[model samples]
Target: MMRVKPSAFVMLAYLIFLLLPIYWLLMMSLKTNTEITSTFTLWPADLTFRNYQTILTDPSWYMGYVNSLIYVGLNTLISITVALPAAYAFSRYRFMGDKHLFFWLLTNRMAPPAVFALPFFQFYSAFGLIDTHIAVALAHCLFNVPLAVWILEGFMRGVPKEIDETAYIDGYSWPRFFVKIFMPLIASGIGVAAFFCFMFSWVELLLARTLTTTDAKPIAAIMTRTVSASGMDWGVLAAAGILTIIPGALVIYFVRNYIAKGFALGRV
Candidate 1:
C-alpha cells in the first residue's frame, strides 16, 4: 500500500473547508421548507423543484438575473480593456514612480466597499445614472480593475521580454504585436482575471444593492428583498441563490484549463 503525502492530506482538508458552506447551500436548496425548519436533516427529506419553478416563473426573479448578467458582463469587459494595457506597461516598463503607481492602483482593492457606498450613490445620482446597469458596472470597476491589473501583471511578468523584442525586430507594430502575438501568450492570464472580476462583481451585494433600485437591481439585491413584512421566503431565496451559482459555475468550468495553467505559471 502507498502512503498518502502530508501535502495531499492538507489540500484535501482545505478543499472540504472551502466547499462546506456551498454544500450546505445546495442541500438547503434541494429541501422543502418543512424539512429545512422542522428539524436539521443532513439531506433533504423531500426533494422538490418548486423553488426553482417559483424563481423561473416570477418576472421579478428573472429580471434580477438579467440585470446581474448585464452589469457583470459590462464590468468584466471594462476591467479587462483597461487592465490589459496597464498590466503590460507595469510588466515591461520601468518609469518614474512605477512602483508607487502600482501600489496606488492596488490600494483601490483594499478600500472597504461600505466606505464608498454613499459617495457612489450620490455620484451616480448626480450623473443621472442611478438604478442603471452602467452605474453598477462602473462601481464594480473600482475594485475589479485593480484586481485585474494585479493578476494580469503577474502573468505578464512571467512572459519573456524577448518575445516583445523579437516582435518589434520583425517589424510588428505595438498594437499588432499585442493583439496577435502577446495576447495569445497571456490568454490564460486574461481568462483568470476575467473570471475573478465576474465572480466578485456577481456575488457582491452592498454596492450593487445601493447603486440600483427596482428596475435594474441585481439578483443580490433581489435576494435581500426576500425578507419582508410577511416573512422570509427561505425556499425562494435558496433557489435564487442556487440559480445564481449556475452562470459562475459554467464560466469556471469552461475556463478551468486556462485557470490551472495560469496559476501554475505563478500568476495567481
Candidate 2:
C-alpha cells in the first residue's frame, strides 16, 4: 500500500476548507426555504431549481446583473485607458515630485471606499449622475485607476527603454508606437490590471449601493431583496450568489495565465 504524504493531506484539507462554503451555498440553492430553515441535512432532500428560475425570469432580478456588468466593463475600460499613459510616464520619465505623485496616487487606492462615499454621492448628485451606470463606473475609477497605474507601472518598468528608442528610430509616431508596439509587450499586465479592476468593481457593494438607485442597481444590491417581512429567502439568495460568482470565476479562468505572469513580473 502506498502512503499518502503529509503535504498531500494538508493540501486536501485546505481545498476542502476553501470549497465548503461554496458547496453549502450550492446545496442551499437547491433546497426550499422551509427545508433550509428546518433541517440540518448536508444535502437537499428534494433538489429544485425554482430559485434560479425566479431570478432568470424576473426582469428586475436579471437587470441587476446587466447593470453591474455595464458599469464593471465601463470602469475597466476607463481605468486601463487612463492608467496606460500615466504608468508609461512613471516608468519612462522622471519629473519633480514624480515619486511623491506616484505615492499620492497609491494613497488614493489605500483609502477606504466609505471615506469617499458621501463625497461621491454629493458630487454626482450635483451633476445629476445618480442612478446612472456611468456614475458608478467613474466613482470606481477613483480606486481602480490608482491600482491599475501601480500594477501597469511595475510591468512597464520591467520593459527595456531600448524598445521605445528602436520604435522611434523606425519612424513610429508616439501614438503608433504605444498602440502597436508597446501595448503588446505589456498585454499580460493589462489583463492583470483589467482583472483586478473588474473584480473590484464587481464585488464592491458599499459605493455601488450608495451611488445608485433602481435604474442602475447592481446584482449585489438586488440580492438584498431576499430579505422581506416574511424573513429571508435563503434559497433564492444562495442561487443569486452562485450566479454572481459565475462571471468573476469565468473572468479568472480566462485570465489565469496573465494573472500568473503578473505575479511573477508585475505588482498584481
Candidate 3:
C-alpha cells in the first residue's frame, strides 16, 4: 500500500472539519429524543423517520418551505433582471459618478440585515405589503441586486470590445445583439449570480422573518417557533435545518461547473 502525502492528509483534515457538523446534524435528525438526551452515540441507537414525517406532514412547517422557494425564486429573478442592465452599463459605458455609483451599490450589501428590519417592516406595513411573499422578495433584492451586479459586471467586462463593434457593423440592433449574442457569452456568469441570489435569500432569517407573518413566513422563521412552553424539539429543528439546505444544495449541484468558469471570466 502507498502512503498518503502530507498535502493529502491536510486536505482530508479540512474536509472533515467542513463535513463533521453536517454529519452531526444528519445523525441528530435520525435519533429519537431519548437517544439524543441520554446517550452520546456516534450512530443513533434507533433510527426513525418520524422527524422527517413531522416536517413533511405539517402544513405550517411544509408551507414555509414552499413560501421560501417562492420568495427565493422571485428574488433571484428580480436581481438578475435588474443587474443585467446595470452591469452592462457599468462595464461598457462611462457616465457621471459611475465609479462612485458602483461602490455605492455595494454599500447596500454591507448594511446589517438587523438594522433594516424595522424600517422594512414599517415601509411594507405602510404599503400594506407586510406578511406577503413579494415583500420579502423585494426586501431581499437590496442585497442580492448588489451582489448580482458585481458578479455579472466582472463577466461582462471580459467580453471583447470587438464583438460589440462587429455586431454594430453587421447592423444588429442593440436589443437583438444583447439578447442573441451578449447573453449567451455570459451564461456562466448568470448561472453564478442566480445561485448566489438564491442561496442568500433562501437562508436569510432576519429580514424574511420580519417581513413575513402567517401567509409568507419562511422555514427559517418557522424553525424559530420550535421552542415551546414544554421544551425545544431538537429533532424537529434539526429536520427543518436539514430540509432548508435542500434548495441551496440542489442549486449549487447544478451550477457547480459554472462557478469556476464564471470566476475565470473575472480574471480575464
Candidate 4:
C-alpha cells in the first residue's frame, strides 16, 4: 500500500473544494430539471442531454455564443495589433511624461467597467454601431489595449535593444523588422495578451450586454436572461455554463506553454 503525505491530502481536499461547483453544474446539466429539483445526489439518477439539445437548437440561445465569439475574436485582433507598436515604443524610448503616460494607460484598466459602460453605449449609439459585434469589440479595446500594452512592454524590455540597432544596420525597414524580427522575439507576450483579451471579452457581461441589444448579445448576457414565468431553467442554464467554459479551456490549452513562460518571466 502507498502512503500519502499530509500536504498531499491537503492539496487534494483543496482541489476538490474548488472543483465541486463545476462538478455539480456538469451533473445538473446531464439531469432533467424535474430530477434536479426533486433530489439531491452526487451523480444524476437519470441522465439526459435534452438541455444541450434545446440550447443548440434554439436561435436565441445559440446566437449568443456566435455573438460572443465574433466580438472576442475582434477584440483579440485589435488589442494585439495596437499593442505591438505601442509596447515597442514604451520599451525602446523614454520621453517627457512617458512613465506618467504609461501609468495613465494602466489606470484605465483598473477602473470598473461600470464606469465606462454608459459612455461606450452613447458613443457607439452615436455612430449607429450599437447591436453590432464590432461595437462591443471596439469598446473592449479601451480596457484591453491598456493591459495588452502593459504586458507586452515587459516582454519587450526583456529583449536587448541591440536587436533593433542590428536590424536597422542590416538595412531592414521599420515595418519589416517589426513584423519579421521583433514580433517573434516576444511571441509569448503576444500569446499571453491575446489569451487575456479573449477571456475578458468572452465572459464580460456588463459591456457586452449594455453596448448591444438582441443582435450582438453575448452568451454571458443570455445566461442571465434565462428567467421565465415557469421559474428559471436551471438545467439549460447549467448546460450553457458548461458550454461557455469550453472556449476558455480551448484558449488556455493552445496558450499553455506561452502563459507558463509569461509567468516565469514576470510581467505587469
User: TM-score rank, highest first?
Assistant: 2, 3, 4, 1
Each prediction's whole-model lDDT (CA): 0.89, 0.93, 0.90, 0.88
Score residue 42 of candidate 1 by CA lDDT. 82
Q: Judged by lDDT, which candidate is best?
A: 2
User: What's the lDDT for candidate 4?
Assistant: 0.88
Candidate 1 local lDDT, 1-268, one digit each (tens): 9999999999999999998888888888888887787889887888888888888899998999999999999999999999999999999999999999989988999999999999999999999999999999999998999899988988999999999999999999999999999999988888889888998899898999999889898987788777888777777788888888899889989888787755553354
Q: What is the TM-score of each candidate against the true structure?
A: 0.89, 0.96, 0.96, 0.95
- Candidate 3, residues 8-102, lDDT tens digits: the string is 99999999999999989999999887888888999888998799999999998899999999999999999999999899999999999999999
Candidate 2 per-residue lDDT, tens place, 103-182, comes to 99989989899899999999999999999999999999988999899889999998999999999999999999999999
> Higher-lDDT candidate among 1 and 2?
2
- lDDT of model 2, residue 136: 97
Candidate 4, residue 99: CA error in Å? Answer: 0.6
Report the C-alpha lDDT of model 4 over 197-240, residue by residue, as the tens digit.
88777877888899888999998888887789899899999999
Error of 1 at 223 (Å): 1.2
> CA lDDT of 268 in candidate 1?
49
